[model samples]
Target: MVMVEYMDNVKLGMLDGFLTRNHQKSLKSLFSRNKSPNANDNGDDDPSSAALNSPKSIPQLSPFANSVVSRCSKILQVPTEELQHHFDTQLPESVKELLTYARNFLEFCSYQALHILSSHPDYLNDKEFRSLTFDMMLAWESPSVETKPQDKETTCSNQEVEDEDGWSIFYSSSTNMAVQVDDKKTVGPEAFARIAPVCAAVADIITVHNLYDALTSSSDHRLHFLVYDKYIRSLDKVIKASKNALASSIENLQLTEGEIVLDVDGTVPTQPVLQHIGMSLWPGRLTLTNSALYFESLGVGLYEKAVRYDLATDMKQVIKPELTGPLGARLFDKAIMYKSTSVAEPVYLEFPEFKGNSRRDYWLDICLEILRAHRFIRKNNLKETKKSEVLARAILGIIRYRAVREAFHFFSSHYKTLLAFNLAESLPGGDLILKTLSSRLLLLNSGAAQHDLSGSPHAKWQPKLSPVSLIALTQLGFMLQKDVHLDAEAIIVGDVCVGEINPLEMAVKQSVLDTGRAEAAQATVEQVKVDGIDTNVAIMKELLFPVIELASRVQVLASWDYPCKSTAFLMLSSYFILRGWIRYILPSIFVFVAVVMLQCRHFNKGKPLEPFRITPPHNRNAVEQLLTLQEAITQVEALLRSGNIILLKIRALMFAVLPQATDRIVLLLVFMAAVFACVPLKYITLLVFLEAFTREMPYRKESSDRWLRRIREWWIRIPAAPVQLIKPDDRKKKKSLDDRKKKKS
Candidate 1:
């Protein structure tokens, strides 16, 4: 009878192996020690069920429980919604269990028959029950499986076994226990055979709640801790696995018999700091890469913060043509000479009243002392290298010396009065300066006497006009002056609104102008006065020639030019004054840039004999011509405001024609070629307009001539073109040429 039963059992086992090959391995590892493998099989009908009741050979399942928990914990970190959905369609796990595991709960079985209750179709109808079920799923942990009517203990027979070395009592053989029969399943057929049919019967009770829906529905605190802890732990493992690329070393880091997770040891290094920011698992490939980029961005931002505080401040002091060493001393000497000349003037002659009290007085003394130290260092025959130190000491002396302070007091009082006068006029009356200047110029040009113009016939009538009269009377004279005023006003508004100067016009003009200035300045050598000898004096004269030439141009600008006249001159003067006072306090680079800009402007705009001028038509009244000029100015100004603010039409025209226009490709091509040729930064940014538009340009040809030719062709094709002159004789000449060509052909 035992032999027949054994044969029947073997046949059943083989069939089971075929049915659950995949789940068998896990089941063998999970339920291998269950004494009653057929505990719920209702085997009163099957004779072999009685044979399975022996307990001697059954391995203990308690040890495998931790391993099962650990495995689930690690898997929970993965994007499991898709996987859970797949399992839902393929397997028979309850919806609650699917969601609980999907949510990565640390404990999954705490709520009473949660999966069973959630599986009912009617569960959705009871909002409260559904809500409660969701909360349980989020926070659930394992509990003993619910007791069932079928859980009755069966009286089993005990057996004895004899081996070569020993005799033993066998309650059950290993074969009869939950031993793996195939690689198809995690739990054997014997384990689920009893549960499968029961689960299938409860299909009507199943719900399909996913982790996302569960989490969305519930806000339970207990569930949060379980979900988060497990999720984080799962993430830690996932990150580690990802780093290792799911290699074999993962398996080698195995747990002990009953242990679920590997314990942290002194040997293994801790996880990176970024891992602790959240209570969620490590991200997948795309998310992980994005996270790494964000971390890098944060690191860069932190470094930039330090740069702003420390390095940027220092950078402001460096990168200057001025204040390097020798150049600063020369500027200081010039300033002292200017101060001394000014002190001899009528306004500055009486300096006594200023001696009592003033901050301006204090700063002036500092400047004077610096100048004195600089002179003293030279006069006493100090070492050339030590001159700067002495100058610095002289600066300190001005700050501290009493006699210097009195001189400073006079200078400071005069400076303050001048500054206040200029500020009031420049800031408040600035609105009217250009208008007044234009009106004054227009009046000068219009020769009609005031008394003679009072009741003349033309008083009631507007006069006839021509384009030339329009250009001369309005734009070239009156309207242009008004336009300057309007432009200045617009600039102020723009600066306030945009929080920056609109250097577009200035930048465009400077683009070409800078090249000229740079070349000229470079040609000019540094100058030093020679002692005693006639040859040394000649050398000094030669050395000083370039600077004298540049200074002469500045004098012309200071004497003439609308932008530098009156208020303009006063504004620039005050700028220099303020600059001198704060030279030590502020960075030398700022002052250097300012001075370079001034010198460049003077050379470019204040040169003798300007090549172009706005001439009037042959005949027209000054008033009519002025109105026409005003309209033209208005149109041009509007165009400038709309686009390419840096290049006004007049300036663009000047850039086109002036400055030896023959085959030079223009600033744009020159800039592009330089960039292609990897030019130095100072030269690189010389052409501001070109630099702005083509900043990201890839390298191309370095030949400026080729580049220039192309640019000229492009410029000719552009929409804006200057008006051309036509001659009646040219038409006759062209006809004859055409006739001759036809005869030749």
Candidate 2:
């Protein structure tokens, strides 16, 4: 009776399931779409080809699914209706919907089974059916057999469909889609698809078991064990299949003329061609051969080709090791960065620990050995050339490498100095330094006999003088002293042996002797020039010659009596001209014009420069003379306290230390100006127009007081008429009112 029942189930499965006329039609349609005329012409009897051509449709009464379902039902003694009811009440809305679909599909299966059984009565007693049924009931479990007609016009070639139960649908080919069921997300479709029907049957079995337990208050351990056993077997099959596929992929790579030394599972980063950004990681197998390194992605099709790196061609490439941290240890310990000569950036390959050894270190050592061997081979190949020629070429290569390295270092240091120059040039005293140097240059070229240092005896001493010493002497007003001797290499001012000319330290020391506090100044200069004074002092002395002369001129101007107004005016004009021309020509001209305009306005407003209104009566007494001397002392103290003289001295000292500071700053500014000039002229004109329209003018009414307002108003009237035509009535009236108010007070 049992054999008869098995035979009946087998016949029903074969007649109503995948072998049915409808399934054959679907298979024929799929084959026709993929078939070529050449494939039809070949009558190959290969088992693999036959298997590939076989219909992949699933069968009804599948051994894997049906066995689990039948065993659980028999143990629980639950009807199909009871299981469905339990599922409806206990499952979520989504699961309930899936249950409904399954039930509808099962009803269709039953109707078809009945139709087949009625039509083929002779299949009931077939021995072949009985044997096939027994075999299926024992162990047969396979994937589903749902067939959907392929849409050739579909835009999406490989759309992924997934469900909440960790079930995924993959397009197995352009004409077919397959479903896979797995514990986690990483399992391949082929493995899980083979067991998908079994999974569905297990779901049904579990529902029935739970329902029976709820009703009887008893758990069926036998049914539970059977379900778990089937699941474990299914997972085992998946693992074996995955390993086989991996081996097949590795074999297909076809490495060139080398034995594989090492093979490991790892990941390599993939970057798009042409684009410079966005790297994606692909998990793959890494194989190191004697001749090359290869990486094959675990996936099929385009990914199976595997990227190859030839050891000989990439001899100069460097491999860098990087530790990605503890979290990344699961995937890899260290990543190897390979810089390809053809690519803009390096490609990274990460390796996990392989068999208790560090894969990164092992791979790196292998690559180093290969590189060393390649270098040796290359060296031997060069024996054909003359030894002398080879030696000369090698020497030239070494020199070129060193030259490039030193040039890079020099540029880096100078770049830092250039930045410092830019920062200093923006300060207020920076303008003064430039002006002072310009005036000295002008004085030297003006044919002034007193300023001609080139023919002076002290000119010879200038070469020996360090910039620090020159600065110290200038600060002490030594340049203006008449009793200075420069006949010898040693600088001498009066009786002092200031400094010697040979070594910079000696020169600076000798120059410091001219200062009143020689010892302290010498010590300070030594401390500042600690990093070898020769280069810095020589560069400074050469570049800042004009600045030193200007410092002397400043001292001379300060000492002058300015006995007449005309003399003082002429001196002030010359100073302004020299300062303005060097630092900022346009702005200085505007300033000078503004000053002259204000003076003219003052004259037109009937405001004359007045002398002191109250003066003490002249006295020839000694007490009066003493008072005058005390007043002079107070004025000198005030000038000193104001810090102007000290600031000027500091500026001059800075020039001595940074001799090329002005030149570097000017060069940078000019470069920036040139860059700006390259912009469209219209843009510059627009910017200037906008500034003029929006910027607050210096002589605006809000900024001016009553006296300034009168002066500006007088100037405004001059442009409309001659000087006499402008009326001073308003100014005179205001002045009279002010006088009356002063009298009343």
Candidate 3:
């Protein structure tokens, strides 16, 4: 039994050469038996009688072929009894007819299956193999039929044109029923619809077959060369048929009246005309007419209506010209905004480039001319009856143009600065200064500082100040003294001079004392006067109110000034640093380092490296090494003498300096002012430090583009350092839960 099985395996191994010959014989017998005149004449007989009348020459399969059939049956999961029954009994007439037309298709599928199984015996279990087999079955079940109408005269009138490549072109005069023009001939929309299904089917088949071929070819095992050759031929036929159908449909199209000024293929926004929803732009043929613009769909059967815009009524306004980039131009260009009383929204029409020529500007010019002519005709007709009204309209038009020009000029001059300031005021730092100052005032009023103020009128009060407030006040005082030259001593706080004290601290102290004095005076007035009026509280209000007002005003000004100061400091620092190091000193250092590193190794080793070594030596030992080093040095000297290397080095140095040259010069001047001219660098640095540290405070958390936050994260290494790692089992459970949710969804 084992020996017999080995022999059977050897026979099945040689089945590739025999499969094709066997298939041809089987196909010939199948066709001949079905096409017999007597069998047809009998008509719908019993299967046994039909088999008896059929041709006696039944195609016999070898044992190998039978084994192949059995293997395919097993792979298809067909029952053994059903498989035997299908082979033994004759199929019904209708099935035989379908099989006769699909002979080549069935043969192709069977051969493909055989090829896959021969190479990959486990292909029966492959998902890709199952999908491909299903696709092949669907293709075989639905055959392409010529959808020609069955009128004898119409069929006779049809012209059948054939190309050298075997593409059939059928044109019937009856198909032009949809576009029955008195003076012109054209293909109707129904003609495209009739042939669209066949073209779409061919396209789908080509796509699926190509994908299958690609997937199968990418595997480790190779397909038979003939199989690929046959697939390529099938693909070429379908593609050619699709192209010919599209071309024929377009060629038969004719315009109704106007000569086509421009003809191109593009997409138009779908107009809700019938049952179809207007959701996306549909591909269509765009044609520009002398009096109107028209767009017609390329595909048929879809409930899409042709879009038409009458130049006389619909061209209400011509929008300003915009230059769309390459990608936009491919989509559509020379967009015109159009409106009509009938439609709620304005319709946008675009003229795309046709072939290599873009007639967008030409089309636009013609449209404008049409609009102008129409307007002129209407005005001429009305001029005799309404002369005064026409004159008023002309004056209004002139006034409108002049006003628009002046408004544009005004905006161009002043709008940019105002826009920048408005944007700056919206940032978090703008509100931050106000909040910080308000919170500080509230703290001073509510804390023990209020009690200290109530104790004695002569006692001086000094409230604690936040670092941010202190830095802001110091910078403000420095600016006031230097720029405005205002003496801080003009504003007195308690018994001390303002210039001799911290202004913010003094303001907070005064506000706290004022609140305390007001409260105490109110209590005393309620006890003594009974009129709810206190003289001390009123007096204290006048004296201490200005201090709080000044502090509030300073906070508002600081918000505006803080950003400008920080920007100026950064610009100056960058300038000074680049000029001092990057431009001149850094390049010099890089050159010196390169020269030292490249030269020092040879000096220390007493012999040059391979690329710079000398060919020979006058003596052996130490003298030889010294002489070789001299030769290497001479080579280096010769290389430097060529001037190319020196020029390159010079260029490298200049390349580093050119980009930052202007900025460095400007910053150098600012740096000089800050260092030598007493521009208050310490105050700027202190303010910068305080701002950076408090950048993430509660009030400032709304800031989006936080460079300070990024800097802090980088310094800390891990932004979320306290986060815990998930265990492997927990991660698996989470993934499983997610998958289950996805399945349910």
lDDT of each: 0.28, 0.34, 0.34
lDDT (tens digit, per residue) of candidate 2 on 1-745:
2332232222222222122122212211321324332333256454433333332222333333333333222212233333334434433343235323442223222222222221222222332222222222222212122322112121112233645632222312211221221111112222222222122111111112221122112112111211222232333333233335335544666743222233334433442111111255556666554346667666653456667766655346776565442333334446676666754665667665435324455455445444433443354443211221122222222222222222221111111111111211332233342233222222121110112244332221111111222222222222312223322111111101101111212222232233325445557678645222234545566567777887766444443333244346445555644454334667888998899999889776877545323223433466665776688789989988656544653454446434454455568789979968796554554455433322233333244355567755643332211123435887798899999999999
Candidate 2 residue spans exceeding 4 A from truth: 1-251, 258-261, 266-278, 300-303, 324-333, 353-357, 382-745
Better of 1 and 3 by lDDT: 3
Q: How would you encode candidate 3's per-residue C-alpha lDDT over 1-745 as one tens digit per residue?
A: 2332232222222222223222222211321223432433347544433433331221232222232333333332232234334423322232234334232323222332333231232222333333233323222322223222111121112243445753222212222321222211111222111111111111111112222223223222222212222233333333233234334333334433212232233534452211111233445555443345556655674424456666544335443334342333434445555455645565554444444213444334334444443343353443221222222222222222222222221111111111111111222232332233334333221111122224342333343211221111122121101122112111111111101222323343344345456656667767544211233344455557767797775454344446655456545655655444334657887898899998887686876444322223222466665776688789888987655544543454445433454355468678877765664555555556456534544456457237657755543432221225899999999999999999999
Candidate 2, pairs of clashing residues? 58-145, 64-140, 498-510, 498-511, 499-510, 499-511
TM-score of each: 0.15, 0.19, 0.17
Which candidate's TM-score is highest?
A: 2
User: lDDT, candidate 2, residue 660?
Assistant: 54
RMSD of 1: 43.1
Worst 10 residues of 3 by lDDT: 490-499
Please provide the root mean square deviation of candidate 2 (C-alpha atoms, Å): 43.3
